[model samples]
Target chain A: MNYSNFKIPAVAVALGASLGGLVYGYVNEAISLALEAATPYVEQGFEVREDNWSGEVEPGKPLLVKHQLFRGNEYWFWAGTSWPGATIKVDIFDSEGNSVGLESFARDSFAGVRALPQKTATYLIRVVAEYSKTGEGLTDEERGANDPVEGVGEFSGSLDWGLVYGYR
Target chain B: MVMIENVIRIFGRAPLAGLGAVFVATLIFGAGLLNAENAPNAPERIDLSNFPGEMVEKVVVPIPAEIFAVLEKLDEPDWNSGIELPEQGDPVGERAILALTFGSLVGEGFIAVQAKNADEIQTIGKRVLALSEALGLAAAVRPHSLSIIEAAGNSDWKKVRDELDATQQTVRTTMEKLRDDELSGLVSLGGWLRGTNVVTSFISNSFSEDKAELLNQPGLIEHFRGLLDSMKGPSANSPQIRSISTGLARLEAIIAPSTEISEEDINQLRDISRTMLEEYYFEKKAAETGTSIN
Candidate 1:
């Protein structure tokens, strides 16, 4: 039997096939893992917390900044950011977009407000970051004024809150 | 004659041609199986670019906005009157807000969970869907609430109370659905979350623009109800839900306003959340060593 021709070719072919299989497997697996790694960030939500926004509280339900500070939960309070003797109103809606609760706060800073449920849902809570910095109640002009009141820093963007929800 | 016989014998005994056929067949079949398995072809890169950036924005942004709107509505009874009270709304509204808040936190926590766990983006999508379902439930109960509000608008207190009762029933049912949906199988996790991101982003943008606040709007209320009604009979239980529940719980708890927490406190909590998530990853790996991820 002339073994030389068969043996050499067989060994070469086997080595080439093994290399091809390894390369094919490696490339596919690597790409799959990379894609898998990117999935979550592409789908994750914000951890809304208290620090996300500032607001003024009226005489009604205070602006509860449902921030995802500690974990991605929702927390409520009277008002977020306000000057002394400011009036702010906070309104909360349920998942069904119903007005479920309300509260008011009249204080300089709502630094001491209590924390309510931290659970985050599709719940939307809007804070009327209003304040009567003027000695008298906000005049029609003052109320309509876009500028932040006298002696009070700007409160624009006070409604900013964190977006929370889990993703893949 | 002897040589001829020997040649015939060698050819007959060796079966080289048959061996070659077997080799070719093995290669073809092996290649086919591999090809079939790889046929999925990496899901076509998701072209999230074509995915309507507006859709993602609508879904992701509104999640917080919708949750906050509910919180805001619950916190204040009247928008015109700047009056603050300890409590001034229906008790059912209070409970619904709490449950919705829980669901929202869970939704956000699910996002964080996937981020840390090194999972697929689809998991996040499913979470978004779960949140969407919750939003839908909230919406479903809205008609009842709206009936009450409308009756209240008409100064019909009796009708309002009746509607409130009806609203409560809807809420209880929705809550059960949410509890059942407390996270689950990988496919649902992926599909729902992906779809949710698109939906939430859409809602948020629409609300933000026209400068419309959906805080207590009837249209949004109607939307929620419509969504919930559409998804009532679906199953939400899956394996992934259990794995992510604890993390979600922690996240939900963390979102509540804390009198005792400071910046430092929050930072510490975040660190702890990360640590626990890492542990979960290790445990998951250990458990999944032999099972099919699919």
Candidate 2:
């Protein structure tokens, strides 16, 4: 048995398999982080509904989901991504394309928006994930000399995003 | 020596194959990178500036509690006046009928909670259990049913409401997991129809603009109609579904065009909802006794 010839190709196959597993693991982590972002609202007496949405989006490209929100109940929609230093945005819109979100905040890797709908109609929620080149919170030395940080920088590609919502 | 030579020849071919594996691996990794960099056909950006309100991947229907919460603000109507329970008897055998009955019962449970009618809530809880058993979801629903009874016993209206919501959600989720999506939609549809009937009846009594606005749910109507349209096999062709579908279309025609529902609109909706319940949903046992659900 000439086992020596199999060494190089076997290593390449193993490497590819590892990369695939890493991508899957990263996406799952993003989903968990997205749910974690809603903990603050949950503490504020918001009942997080079980229904949620998740998908991959290109950096700077926005994803939209439509939901029927009752007029009286207050709602909070939160989104998160696994990409480090990624800027995320979550907002709600009415049928007329008007911004109906009352309060919103976006930080690295996560964002949230609050909405108290004026009518019980199908409203759109827009979520955006963008790559941050300067790695906003990082120090200059951490930014690396020529390239961006490991997960930041010119690697502007699709990012996995998770969205969860709570109502009070 | 011949075996060694043959092994070397195989090794000579291994470099190309090794390169191919690495190339394939790099391609997989690069695809993820390239997709992020330049997502083909991906819209450059989505903003209110050019947002067409299209592309809706999911729609979450507002639970019955959400509307009940609003109705509470408009001056609590006599929720007891709206407490209409179907006759208690053997569980309906058909899954569709049982699903609708379960939904309507949950809706009634909400009203009972609002009315603070402990007895009615308890009865509704038992009926919910019966219907759930008929639908083969007794295990999942029993706990919620028991919770509803306990909450009603203590008069903890909020807990009762939560349990009711949980009950319907559990049924819908369980049905969906069983791939009975049509039944799941029916459960929601059943609850919505019952809720609407109560709301319209209450609004018609008071006839306030604010109260009437609560019935202005064209989106939900469309959603239920879509559910009906998506049904297949016996569930879709059932007389009850067909009747409700027609009734929903009529409701949609009236509600979709109006930003504000007139008193006339309220009466029409109330009548339509009541008729559907009496004819298709609530009157099953009543027909045998020469009585009505109310």
How does the DockQ of candidate 2 come out? 0.11
Q: Pick the candidate with the highest DockQ.
A: 2
Candidate 2 residue A63 C-alpha distance from true site, Å: 2.2
Return the TM-score for each candidate structure.
0.21, 0.71
Q: Looking at candidate 2, what is the lDDT of residue B286? A: 38
Question: Interface root mean square deviation of every model, in Å?
Answer: 26.1, 16.7
**Model 1 vs. true fold: TM:** 0.21
- Per-residue alpha-carbon lDDT of candidate 2 for residues B193-253, written as tens digits (9 for 90 to 100): 8888888877777787766767777777888889889888876787777888898998998
Q: Which stretches of candidate 2 lie over 4 Å from their true place?
A: A1-47, A54-60, A80-87, A130-168, B1-54, B284-294
Clashes of each: 108, 2
TM-score of each model's B chain? 0.20, 0.78
lDDT tens per residue, model 1, B1-294: 433332222223347654664466456434423312111111212232242211111211223223323323223212212111111122232222334332333333333322232122223223323333544554554454445445545555334333332333343334444664222122122222222332223233223211112221222223332333333332212232332344334433543432333333333333333333332221223322111110
Docking band of candidate 1: incorrect
lDDT of predicted model 1: 0.30
